[model samples]
Target chain A: MVQLTTDNSYGTWRFCAWNGMIFMGVFIVFWGIMGHNVPPYGGDMDASVIANYFRDNANLVRLGMAISMTFAVSYAVWGISIGKVMDYILGRDHILTNLQVWGAGLTVVPILVSSSFWLTGSYRPEALPDEILQLLYDMAWLLIDLAYSVTSVQMIALGVGCLRDKRAQPFFPKWVCWYSIWVGFMFVAEILMPMFKSGAFARQGILNFWIEFMIFFIYAPIITFYQLKAIKRIEAGEPAA
Target chain B: MSDEQSALQQSGRAPGDPGVWFFIIADMAMFAIFFLIFMAGRHEAPELYRASQAHLDSRFGLANTLILLTSGACMAKAVMMARAGDVAITLRYLLLTLGIGLLFGVSKVMEYGTKFAAGIAINTNEFFGYYFAFTGIHFLHWIIGCGVLTVLIRRVRRSGVNAENINWIESGGIYWHMVDLLWVMLFAMIYLLPPGGTA
Candidate 1:
């Protein structure tokens, strides 16, 4: 309930914007830190080419530190803005407890699965018997696909929430709401794309780089910046109604 | 459109949920890509991978898994307690979640610490590299979840936790559960398969 957001003057979402700018700073620093032996950014090498590089990066902590801190601090403010949006159209009746439980259950399980995935993602295929190699490949592949599928649902709900809420007019941007919905819809692409894993465009690791790079370099920062402006505006003055 | 869709469009409440989910999607996307990278990378060095993986310690992974399992339960209980409208009990469960979560962190730090001391730097090769990078990232998340719960507990005490405002707690719980879920995969990938240190 910060009535003090508008005070940032530069904008309500200033902090988030500032955070993004700084994060990009760190990301840029990534190149300098990773001098000389570069991963095949533009073209050919297998994706392992990149993984091994990061696998050998001086310290995982340094880069990770930059990502986690930026998001944590930025989201702290971001969450407040979300709370405000929720208050705007307070629901007539709380969502049924069952639905809430389902949501909570669905949400919780993925966290556990991902955590386990953390330890497991690193296993080298050579260690396992060469005999069952294909089986291992298939299993791991299927598991990841399943995990990604389930987790994507969480994002869909989020997108729906943004799309449905209109009072967010002054605070939340139309782009954010719509983009969220769009992203939710796009996750389906993963399922469909993999079905015909033979498609060169879909299989080529390069495509992932181009699309993901855009999200990181362009969309995330812009959206985060806008979010920061909204928060600052609400935090500085005239508590958001 | 259905009545539900029409009502949601008119009333801001339906769409007004905070941007946490949106932010979470971004984070999850990053993880997904890295995961894909890891899998594809391992596919290349199956021999070195299997050999290196055989050398890893599953016991630690299992123990860590147990700790996180308990923490997830604590997180769920914290939400239920807070919803029950008893400040004292809610605070207790929140504290429980925090303490258990911190223990998970400590265990991970110790796990990594022991590994490092034993000369298993991330770059020891792709196998060890992935070991550190993946688990290392998970460790980072556990720390964040702990910090979140710590702050949340303080907030619950200062401002009562009622149905109107309980989403905050639920959100944190959702995040903590994610931290736990990731561990399950981590164990299977890093410890169960390839035989990290075994023949």
Candidate 2:
């Protein structure tokens, strides 16, 4: 049985991790109801089409964006919890742990920035030209979808660190490690998205948007589930192995 | 067979850890999504898909399928031989499996080369986009599986066949079978299917 030598108890941050899940649920519901979710106004719709959509749902969209911004804060809390766990496992501050922390911090940027774009577009749909509205919409999607490197790096760092836990009962199960690596690699597909206006690689296409989104949604919950379990066992003073 | 071997055989259990199974299930789910999306694309443009598929070399696809199947058979044999306590024969079968797996990789690279030479790319069309995306991802899996196999070979050589090592070897075999099974589905969808008709 491997014992953690750190003085820090992971309990407080574990609660924060659980709260992150709640924030995720809030973001999903608010975004789905108000932000129009992905493929806003249907994936392939033109600038005029999207502009009209914002015109109709401006109030709801703005409210949704405002609420969704909170999701970034939730993510930050979750990321810190993850970094703490990683540090605990390694018994010291390490390069990969730092990378994971930095990556987590950077991930909040896209969500916050992108949601702002959506908010700006919805704030005055009547005053803004269709082209400008479309530009904002495009920028929002590009940041959220194409700027995936930070998240990918975070996953890789966490995954690699988890795989290093060689105890009989590892801090993370091996499957989670492999899952992180595979899903992280999948983010590379986003690079092709900007080139295609249609097809599976398009911004709203099946491979790029739907598949990627579903994977991320499931990935987070799974990690959180395992994390909670690990914390419970740790609190019980069970051997890590 | 030794009494110990017989006792172990009677204990019915799946090879490898439950973690690998979890990984496999999740991977299959992801692939299922890709399949569904591909089907949807076909429904939208039957003619384009059919035309694009026609350009693919079915012969090459068939050859690759055969190689993978044969490799799977060799892997199965290697597991059996290892269980029977015949380390040398197990090594032989494993080597054969690795050889055939590499052959499949080579064929895939050649196929991509031919496509590139003819100016076909992911951006060519909807059909081609699915083609490259699906195959490209599958190819990456193949590379990883090969790496797993190589590691298994090294471990077996260093530690010799034993209870613990056998479990690790079996896990590697399971991963290889997954790669093979995925390729079979891909070959049918990308090569054998008449595009307009569902596979």
Candidate 3:
């Protein structure tokens, strides 16, 4: 077994952290403060009234496309940044395991199903002939979407198991394991949205969005703050591992 | 041989060097926020949800999944190498890890670039919009992971720090795995929404 010890990396790590924060802070401020960032507060898909509005505007349509790509990249980078910071707090060395890779991945299906459901919730087939309705869903799209939702939920459960397996990986914290278990169930709850009568739960899910927001947007950043404080301890001549 | 032996020794990972816990917590938040946004958006649309997924490319999902799995394995081996405390071997694995990360990153750039070129942009549909966004985020992380690996390799060679510290290697490995795992979701959600012709 190889034993490892920590020493100052010629202060480069500190400089890197400081500089990274500064750059990221500036961009985050612009994205948030300047843009009045509304992060997916659920859209009105049922509003043909609203759809008709966007179905016409030229600039709004183009801007929408531009904004989408920007958000995509944003999510990607932010995800990474968050992951790195969390690892820092945990005092762990093993970062990625097969389990985590799969957990991060398998949850995508349910997530997509959830996102798609939110985006197009307003779609109400106007008295389709049974044949057409059959053909419509039978086109294999709805089934896959449904499967994605269901499978995604299953993946979440599997992810929790994966993350919790200390034997597989020693780096995951106890709080994180429990946190994942709790969080995983939330995604599982999402599957029930489709089963609700007339997407009623879909709307309810929006109402419940704050619960998620509190955990992710609010609680998560708070945890990061704590992690940073712990890192400060390490900097102040404390042992992390 | 003595100089090489000295160079091959790892130092500086006692208690101050970074570790995997930070990255794991980071993974938690990243996925947490992602799930939050996805849930928020999903609650907004249910009908287009099904059809949009049905249009995905399972082949792409499987291929990328394989790529990521291979990368994850390479990274895990790198961690194992670091634990062995052989600077040269650890550096070799780090380089290989970088290569795999680059491969994944380049493939993503190609795929997303193709979409951009084809005029079928990210937001072509609500699902596609989110699809590209999530994966795009993962891609950026992949690039960062490669950068981290590169730095570790150089540090080990230049007599800078502990290349054999399990914490450092594991931290990087965890972060990379997070990226890899995110891709798994991206593949399933964005590409393989339909399996065996039944969406």
Per residue, candidate 1 scores C-alpha lDDT tens digits across A78-176 of 333333333332232223212322332353344334323322323443343433433332333334334444434433443444444445364545556
Question: Per-residue error at A34 for model 2, in Å?
Answer: 2.6
Which model is ahead, 2 or 3, in terms of DockQ? 2
Model 2 ranges with Cα > 4 A deviation: A1-5, A9-11, A30-32, A87-90, A94-103, A123-128, A156-182, A185-192, A199-201, A239-241, B1-9, B43-45, B81-96, B196-199
1 against 2, candidate with superior DockQ? 2
lDDT of each: 0.52, 0.81, 0.47
Q: Which has the better lDDT: candidate 1, or candidate 2?
A: 2
- Best DockQ goes to which candidate? 2
How would the docking of model 2 be graded?
acceptable
True contacts kept of 2: 0.44
For TM-score, candidate 2 versus 3, the one ahead is: 2
Least accurate 10 contiguous residues by lDDT in model 1 chain A: A34-43
Residue lDDT tens for model 2, B1-199: 7554576578776677656676777777778888888888888789998889888998889999999999999998887777777788888888899999899989988999999999999889988888888888888888988898888788778777897678877888888999999999999887877766755
Q: TM-score of predicted model 3?
A: 0.44
Q: In model 3, which runs have C-alpha deviations exceeding 4 angstroms?
A: A1-241, B1-23, B29-47, B54-56, B160-164, B195-199
lDDT tens digits, residues A1-241, model 2?
Answer: 3335464466686887676586678667776567887554444678898898789899999999998887777877787787767765664567787777788788889989999999999999999999899899888888888779998988888887887776777778888987887778778878877767777778877778778887887877888888787777667775433
> What DockQ values do the models have?
0.02, 0.38, 0.02
Q: Can you write out model 3's per-residue Cα lDDT over A37-128, one digit (the tens) per residue?
A: 22321233333433333233323323433333233233223333333333433333434322333433443344334323222321333433
Best by lDDT: 2
Q: Looking at candidate 3, what is the lDDT of residue B67? A: 77
